[model samples]
Target: MDVDVLIVGAGPTGLALGIDLARRGVDALVVERGETLAPGSRGKGLQPRTLEVYEDLGVLDEILAAGGAYPVGMIWTDGEQVGRHAMFDPAEDGEEGSRFTGPWMVPQWRNQEILLARLRELGGTVAFGREVVRIGQNAEGVTAHFASGAPVRARYAVAADGGRSAVRRALGIPMAGETLDPDRALVADVRIPELERTWWHVFPPSGPDSGFLALCPLAGTDQFQLVARLSAGAEPDLSPEGVRKLVAERTHLAPEAVTELLWASDFRPRAALADRLREGRVFLAGDAAHVHSPAGGQGLNTSVQDAYNLGWKLGAVLGGRAPEALLDTYEEERRPVAEHVLGLSTAILRAEARRGAATRQLGLNYRHSSLSEETRRDPGPLSAGDRVPDLTVDGVRLFDRLKGPDWTLLTLDSGVFLVRPDGYVGWAGDTEDGLGTYRARVGLG
Candidate 1:
């Protein structure tokens, strides 16, 4: 085999997974069609749960240093300040895991860069400009045939190639989708000189059925992410001139105040889930497995979580520590989570629900997952299949102990509990009765 695993994208999902595997000493190669990392301000919100995943992957410090908190939203009308709105639910000081209470605003490009750097530090590399055109797998391994290069073989492969996944199509896997919005929307990153960075500026349309505009300051950068809702049948212009004209016409900012247009794109909002996340020796992750609406900031965070969920499983099986059945649980667990998260993002996009509790994604859990074994007669707030909250246990932070690629047996607060490497409780009970059997089953010896 050319490598142990072949990752078919270098976005946040692929890079994050690469970091996990590299740290576990797994041989994985990430291949990207683009020569460089994707350039965009999209997927800016890194939710709290994903922040914990980063903490384990060894990139949380860099991620925190490179990003900032979300600013409040400011409404404007006829070039006059109208109202103020909170971007997310506020958190109290000293709250449990308050350090990761809300979403962090880091551009998608910067997040990818940080993950890639960490992957490199762990001796993992991404091969760019190698797009897969065909994929064939047998009992031995999977072979990915590229457009401009020789075929590469691996024991397993992953499709992290975005919403329009070539590998998914090559596998003939169908994607079920729901259209959240028929109207087109423009998403871009721009440098505005006169705009204040303290607030995310919003402007309602001046006329009936007209477009609305919002400019949000990107953390740790002078660039602002500009989003505008377009009228039905209106084609979006991604050019710099078009971006400046849109801002000047819709907001109080002058054309020249929009100093530069960094990156831009247009798309109709929608949510989609693949028919299945796994097929034979290959698996799907990120936008390849599920797509989400831009609202609620769920897409990228969910995608990264997908990688976190699958990475350790792959490492365990490839390292000969766990049974192959462990791989089946990846879909069994993450698929439902993706479906629920899609519902959340779509609800916000359709105005059916406000971006509140669900958008934070802190409450998402695997209680219903078959892999989660709750032996307690009545579980507490942190249960089997639940995210292990960060708490100070005897002077050491729970997260600090859970760091790195190893399952931790937390025998405090709760009785004996087996916490998975991704910070979820795998088994919990009032006592250590079945700990030995469970450990042997999951190869935790």
Candidate 2:
């Protein structure tokens, strides 16, 4: 095998996996179909949970510096501002329990830049224009054949490819979930007359037939992304002229004022999840595993997180330091989380389109597993419906003590908590007897 693991895709998911694996001193190869790193802002808004993951990867500071701080979170409206929940605000929730208080809005392009730079610094380069054409697995390892006729072997293969995943297709894996919705949303990044002090504005029922308009300011650029639900067969051009007309009709702006259309693209909402996140020695991550609506900007963040969860496990398994069962936890841990994100985003979009009741701000808490048996059970496994709590127990901040390579064990009141390498809690108990039992379960005994 030319490498320990083969990663297919060079976007945030693949690059993030590369950074994690390389930093851990693992031999991995990342391949991408694009000739060069894509240059455009597709997704923005980094969730607070993702920031904690980035912190674990040692790149949170850089991401924070490059991104814009958004103190105010998403606003829900049923024709009027019905709910305005704070997402990431330490002041609102207090210091200890506010794990992800405020989310930073960084363009996806910029985040990719940082990931690529970090990967290079760690002595790894993503091989561009390398598309995997065929993949074969044996008892010992796997071999991948690229379109360029290069054969690369590895102990494991991960499909971080996009929605149209070639590797997943080749493996005959089925993508199971809801079909793509019929609604067509027109998106464009353009410089319009200043929105003044407002950060985001949503005009509900902006058009006849329950259509709405969402205007959000883009950080680091003198542009605002306009998303409007178009009428069926409305045929709105994304060009400057079309955006001008849409803005004028939906808001107070005049058509003549909107100019400088930077980029425009149209997308249909689709929610899907791979039937299985792994197949034999091959695994899937990012859009290759699941895709959600762009309503809350969770698409990229979730996929990047999938890689973050899977990278360390793959490295450990391939390095012969952990049992093969550790890899199964990747799907066990993330599939349910993605399921929650998909449903939450779907609800957000439906509410926006139909002016329904506002759902709670998105939150993810892992409460399903043998490990949770020792601790108080959460309502259920982490869902997009629940917020992850931050540190502040027994006069210590969890993040403050959570630096370094090993998984952190944290307890609030003289107890033991086993944190998995991917940052998930494997066990938590207040008594040594309970801790010992859970520790043995996690292979920590």
Candidate 3:
């Protein structure tokens, strides 16, 4: 085998998975079709739960430095300030136990750069310009044939490519979903010197035929992300002058006020989920498994968490610490999560729900999974399948103890809990009654 795991794509999901696997000493490679890393501020919001995952991956400090809090929304009408709108609900007081209370604003491009750098720091490799055209799997391993290079064989393969995944299509996996919006939306990063950096400037449409425009100042960078909805069936002009014209027509800024057009793309929002996340030795992750509307900022966070969930399992199996069957739980645990988050994204896009705790994804759990075992007759608020909140016991941070790639045996006032490497509780009981059985089942024995 060329490598233990072949990750197809170098976006957040693939790079993050590479980092996790590299840290565990798993021989893995991340291959990207693009010559360089992706260059856009696409998924800009990082949820609190993702922050915790970053903390464990040893990149939280860099991520925190490269981003800032989301700015308040400022409404403008007729080129005049009208009102102020908060982008997200205030963080609840009870969430203080967790380090991050709300979402942090880091452009997706910058986020990937950080992940790639960290992956390389751990001696991981990413081969660019290697696009997988076909993937074949057998009982021994999987082989991926690229568009322009030699085929790569590995014990397992993961498809972290975008919603239109070639690996998934090659495997004949169907992506079932619906278009969330008929009107196409334009998203770009531009330098607008006249715009103030303090607020996310919003412009309401003047006429019924027009659509709203918003300019959000990207944290840690001088550029602002521009988003504008176009009329249905209209093609978005992604050129510089065209973007300037759209800005002038939609807001008070003139065509030339947009000094630099960094990157731009247009998309019709949609929600989709793959019929299955795993096909033999190949596993689907991130957008390959599910696609969500860019609402409630769930798509990117959910994708990264998908990597976090699968990383440890792959490591355990590859390191000879767990059986190959452990990989089955990856789809079992993450598909339901992708399904639930897809609904949340659609609800937020339609204004049916507000961005709050649900969007944060801190409450996500896996209680129904076969891995969760609760021997206690009366489990307290915390249970086997729930995320363990960061706590300070005896002046030591719980997250500090759970930072590495190992299971943690934590004892709290309620009971004794066995935490999985992914930070979820795998077993809980008044004592260590059923812990041995659970550990043996998961391959900790």
- Candidate 1 per-residue lDDT over residues 1-445, each given as its tens digit: 8899999999999999999889999999999999999999889999887887888888889999999999999999999999999867755543545366788889999999999999999999999999999999998889999999899999999999999999999999999997888789999999998888999999989997788899999998999999999877888989989988888889888888888998999988889999999999999999999999999899999999999999999999999999999999999999989989888888787778887767777778888887788888867777899888778878889888888899988897667689998888999999999878888888876
Q: Which pairs clash in the backbone of model 3?
A: none
Using TM-score, give the best candidate's number. 3
Give the alpha-carbon lDDT of every model. Answer: 0.90, 0.72, 0.93
- lDDT-better candidate, 1 vs 3: 3
RMSD of each: 1.3, 4.7, 0.9
Candidate 1 wrongly placed segments (more than 4 Å): 94-98
Q: Looking at candidate 1, what is the lDDT of residue 8?
A: 96
Q: What is the lDDT of residue 189 in candidate 2?
A: 73
Check candidate 1 and list the clashing pairs.
Answer: none
Worst 10 residues of 2 by lDDT: 353-362
- Give the distance in Å from residue 154's predicted Cα in candidate 3 to where it truly belongs: 0.4
Considering TM-score, which of the candidate structures 1 and 3 is the better prediction for this target? 3
lDDT of 2: 0.72
User: Looking at candidate 1, what is the lDDT of residue 92?
Assistant: 58
